[model samples]
Target: MTNAADARQTKPDWSAVRLHVVTGKGGTGKTTVAGALALALAAGGERPGARRVLLVEVEGRQGLAQLFEAAPLPYEERRVAVTPDGGEVWALAIDAEQALLEYLDMFYKLGPAARVLRRFGAIDFATTIAPGIRDVLLTGKTCEVVRRRAESGQGPGHGHDRVFDYDAVVMDAPPTGRITRFLNVNSEVSGLARVGPIRNQADAVMRVLTSAQTAVHFVTLLEEMPVQETLDGFADLRAAGLPAGGVIVNQARPIVLPEDRLKKAAQPGGLDQAELEAGLAPVGLADPEVVTALAALAAEHAQRVLLEAEQREALAATEAPMYELPLLGDGVDRVGLDLLARELRRQGAA
Candidate 1:
């Protein structure tokens, strides 16, 4: 019991954070990182309980479904997998058209008007070309679920079976290039929607977005462009009055060389050719040519080691909690994703 108390005390205190918005440069594997984060948060507690988290995708790309190895998800929520601590993860791909219809039903109780709107090009035009409306709908739906209030003080699986009563909601948001614009719905709709239900919806979403309950995490690679994008994204979130979460460095490679060897290799002509040749002599390759080649290989590895160190330093300068996901030799399959989830939990990203 003493040990249990200590462990509980040391656990990451993210209970107040209910919404996690993940975005990064394209091809940074932000989707995979978001899925793993959801799993980590769902099972973050040591004791198994009925905690549940929702994973959402808004681009209609079916990326979340692909990561979970499930069929494409409809707008409706469905159980995707169980976390290590027996928590549940529900996935939803928020189709713009469906979200619009749902919004109408919720606001106007438009039973037939929704079908009529779909019959015309209104749905397509609004979701495709109506600037900022699409963003409002996407963000509004996510925030609505995040801020859902259970009726009659009932829990999940109780009186009303509140489906949206999740402990947290992790969104596989748009890439860094569009994330700020996507999330800043209030600004986007301020010009177009001044005083209507649309404006009201945007305002409601902004309240949740700017609150401490929400955090937008950026995923990056240990490279120049992605790191720059992560920094820019962080700045944009701050400017938009949104809370910035930790920095997640994905597909990070470990430094294979020892500290002493790395230091020696960094110096000019510091490697001893004779020592390399002697080490290779046991394998019947005492040739000077072989030694030179080995030395070149070491130098190349040393350069990478130095570069990785510089990248990590830049990331650390952000002053946000930094978490790293290792590059799996085998590609990110189901088992690999689970391994990543465990790593995230260990690093306290949950």
Candidate 2:
């Protein structure tokens, strides 16, 4: 696949992937991972005009806004970040109610009638009282944006046109628990609309969703529950025939202790006070209190390393290509996000 930043460089592995849906267990940092992936795709094509990528959130949460350090986003798409190569990451927060209105306007051309439906609570029924339509609208709108083209500036007549085109679209999708139902448009709309425009719409959306052009990436922490969720989620995606992408392991702590040292530290009271004091003596006068503190620190490091190893092993069982993000000592902010994007690019997730 061509690089997201440069159409010239061929990185065929992920270049053909047009839609990237990121989902994981709650609190696994899927939103942060999604944002960083967008930035990575946005890096590297400085010479030619940079390619554009879109980031979307659908859970009514302002996660994208928080990560980008921007105000709460409206339903409309807006430019949120610029990459080193001048590529752009545009974001959208899909509001269920607004998407329904837009759907009516686009296909039915409801015009003033839309307000009447809203006033009488019909809009609420279709978007909320009713099931599946809301999910349809959310996923449908995202697919539409994925397929939308740039304005050619020439019109056969007077009609609205999409102003921008994206090389790829990244969705910070719902948690694993709800994701299958959320993306399974056929199942969602099956009971509600059997044979109408809504069903047809659901069909189109599913076509895009299950096609090779789209990939569903699962993010997870290197722990038991999240890893198990990742495994289960992948199983569901496979059962549904959805293309599963890579596994993103986030907030991984660094291994500070070397093997021999860690082995010694693992033993109860193995760190000798005299040895610690001797080491400290080179820098300055060693104290009994300092040696005790150092010994405690060694034990902690040993425990963390052992835990991390177990978690890493659990994550490896999933067999999906893995991408890891470091645990930022400082809280995650826009700058930290940029650093993460660089790491992702280096790891070839872009």
- Highest lDDT against the true fold, candidate: 1
TM-score of each: 0.90, 0.89
Tens digits of per-residue lDDT, candidate 1, 1-350, equal 01111232334645678999999999999999999998888885644656788899998899988888899898788889897667888998987888899889988899789979999978987777676999998988899889877655564423334445887899999999888899999889888889989999998999998898998899998899999888888888888778889888899776777888987877789588898888889999889888888788888888777887788788766777778888988988878889998888777678
- Model 1 scores a C-alpha lDDT of 0.83
RMSD (Å) of each candidate, 1 decimal: 4.5, 5.1
User: What TM-score does structure 2 among the candidates reach?
Assistant: 0.89
- Candidate 2 lDDT trough over 10 residues, lowest sum: 1-10
Clashes of 2: 1
Write down the worst ten-residue block by lDDT for model 1: 1-10
